[model samples]
Target: MSNDVEHAKRALRAELRERRQLLSDAQRETAAAAIGARLDALVDSIGARSISCFLSTTTEPGTRDFVARAAGRGIRVLLPITRADGLLDWAVATDDGEIAEGLHGLPEPTGEVLSPMAVNDVDLMIIPAAAVDRTGMRMGWGRGYFDKTIGSMQKCPPVYAVIYDSEVLDSLPREVHDQPVTGVVTPTQTLNLSQTRH
Candidate 1:
């Protein structure tokens, strides 16, 4: 990526993050609950037994409730453990337990490490993104972790990036390496991109 492109991406990320931080605590909680309910409906509609999902951070769309509810309902939810090389390792998500601190200040589950390619076994994948365009291209935080992870999957499943409703965009500063997602799930609806080759 060119320096100008990288700069643009960083600027966008900062702007979107700032917007997310502006949401009040009560508003964030209510939006999270609604997203969780919609997610549950998506899970049921697809009958996804095993899913690869991310653990949400403080300012992002909250995934704690959704992760727990899915687990409680017997869905095999897997959380990513960020590796130093920018690839992610998979582990079963548990509702109760002290989460281990992973790279990028993300908290991960303390469980057995599955192969990085374990994503191929999942029926669905829900990841995080700062913004996504109409063409399914996701402009994530600078690292490109999810892009790398998804690009390597031999047989990828339906992938969705969870974000606040306002994060959806008509276009973003995209790159060739930026992996496009199958759809994007927001507080209100799921935007499925039609050309999901994976």
Candidate 2:
């Protein structure tokens, strides 16, 4: 990507992070509850048994409720383990209490380390996002973790980014390596994209 596009993404990320940080605890809790319901509906609608999902930071839309709910329902949930080289490995999240502060300062699950390609075994994927466009273009934290993971997959399940409703946009600056997502889940609804991918 050009310097200008990279710069624009940085500015947008900063703005969104700031906005998320400004949210009050009560607001965050309510949003998390609503999003958890939406996620449950999606899981039921798709009949997802095994899923690759993320553990969100306090500032972002909370996934604690959803993660716990999924596990309680006997759904297999996998959380990302950030590698030293910036790639990701996988671990099964049996309980939220088992998650501790892991690599790159994100909450990671405690379990047998699944290889990076383990994501390919899942029914669906849910990722964190700074924002995403209607076209399914996801603006991640600019780490390229998901970018590389998705790119390396020979056959990837549907990748969805979870964000607040206001963060979904009409478009975002793009680059060659920036992989668009399959859809986005927000407090209001899931915005499924019309793009085709494996």
Candidate 3:
């Protein structure tokens, strides 16, 4: 990666982190509810019986409600478990699943661990992002986990990044390894930012 792009990404991620930390409890609750509804609708629209979704951190937009509701509806939800090798493992999401802090302090499922290939079966993917540009370029939180996962898939599904409404920008700093999303789901709306997704 070029030094300029790396520096830009670092600065943007820090600003986004600070912004997320500043959200009030009430604001987070409202955003979580709205995000859950939007995600549910997105899943239904795509008719995805199996999907991969990230367990959100406290500062990020919450997906716990959607994960619970999706599991309740009998949809197979795969939660990510980060690996030390800079990859992500997989676990099935359940209403009563135990969550433990995984690598990088991210929430992870404490169930039977599946290989990274488990994600290949998912019909859709909902991931976390600091911001996404109008063209579907996703700026993640400095970790290349999602980017590597998507890039390694033989048949990648429609990947959507969930972020706050204000995080949608006209453009963003891009690197060769930064993966683009098919769309974005915010508290208010869902936007399909790319036409290349199959």
Candidate 1 Cα outliers beyond 4 Å, as residue runs = none
Choose the strongest candidate by TM-score.
3
**Of 1 and 3, which scores higher on TM-score?**
3
**Candidate 2: deviation at residue 73, Å?**
1.3
lDDT of 1: 0.87
Clashes of 2: 0
- Using lDDT as the yardstick, the better of models 1 and 2 is 2
Pairs with backbone N, CA or C atoms under 3 Å apart (clashes), candidate 3? none
Better lDDT candidate (2, 3): 3
Considering lDDT, where higher is better, how would the candidates rank from best to worst?
A: 3, 2, 1
Best candidate (score: lDDT):
3
Off-target runs (Cα >4 Å) in candidate 2 are none
1-198: candidate 3 lDDT, tens digit per residue? 588998998999899899999999999999999999999999999999999998999999999989989998999999999998989999999988679999898899988999999999999999999999999999998889999999999999999999999899999999998889999999999999987653
> Candidate 2 lDDT, tens digit per residue, 77-163?
988999989789998888644877896788888888998988888888899989998888888898899988988889888888899
Give all candidates' CA lDDT scores.
0.87, 0.88, 0.93
